[model samples]
Target: MKYPVTVYGDPLLRKKAKAIEKDHPKLDEIIENMWETMYYSDGVGLAAPQVGLSIRLFVIDASSGADEEPELEGFKKVFINPEIIETKGDEWTMNEGCLSLPEIREDVSRHDEVTIKYLDENFVEHTETYKGFAGRVIQHEYDHLEGILFVDYLSPLRKRLLKGKLIAISKGKVRPHYRIKVPK
Candidate 1:
């Protein structure tokens, strides 16, 4: 089943997610649903919080058809109880968008590489390092687990400029290509 993506106004999006146990009930099913919902929403990544589940889980598939980022090709993976061990290298700016934030996109600066420890769908633990677009995607999704939006990285002036637009999104005034659940 595909879950409706939660909009920015949802309080759950602002809450830090909790880590799930290895024996989390229906873990596999939830991961499957996340993938389905992500594809339906045409997002490269989706955090559990984006679906109104305050759990430490996310899914990513950065296979661009145009081979724009070759490193991201076939980079599908499921992250459960993920922890960023370290972030290294220089910071670079990239335009980032979120399933929860809808039409808003902004250039956020992030490290060029990241080392993360996480569990897979089967509860298998692994530590991996990613670079370039893959690292950016991971960092973006990881922020969701910590209740941090990309907009938070923007300057005060930039944030102020976009305040109205952000409020509009929170109020469900924006139209995204995919389905979203707005706060009542």
Candidate 2:
């Protein structure tokens, strides 16, 4: 199923997500639906909150071509209740965008490599290290689980200039009836 993506300024996008308690009836279905929604939208990642779900879940597949590396193949990954256990090295700046924010893209600084601990789709625990573009995608999707958007990293001046546009987006002026609601 292709779920609706909440746009910028949606209250649900600002609220931190709650951790998934256990393997539930619709968990697997939701993951599958999210992947379908993400691929349909040409997004590298999709968080539960983006689809108006408040659970701490997100999907990432960074197997796309990067500016530095063009021949990279993508991989599909799902992170449930994920945490960055370790991060090393200096920050790298990359132009980042979000599915929720539509066409907006901004330069954001993130760690070049990270080690993350997360629960997989089958409820198995795993820890893996990622570098380069994969690392960036992980960090980006992880931020969504915490209610952080890529625009939050923008400069104060730029943010101020974009405030009206963001507000209009949130209010559904630009894309009416497309916003999804977070389940209470």
Q: Global lDDT of each model?
A: 0.91, 0.81
Residue-level lDDT of model 2, residues 135-173, one tens digit each, is: 888888888888899888888999998888777666655
Clashing pairs in 1: none
The alpha-carbon deviation from the true structure for residue 139 of candidate 1, after best TM-score superposition, in angstroms, is 0.3
RMSD of each: 1.3, 2.9
Model 1 segments more than 4 A misplaced:
none
Measured against the true structure, the TM-scores of the candidates, in listed sequence, are 0.95, 0.88
Winning model by TM-score:
1
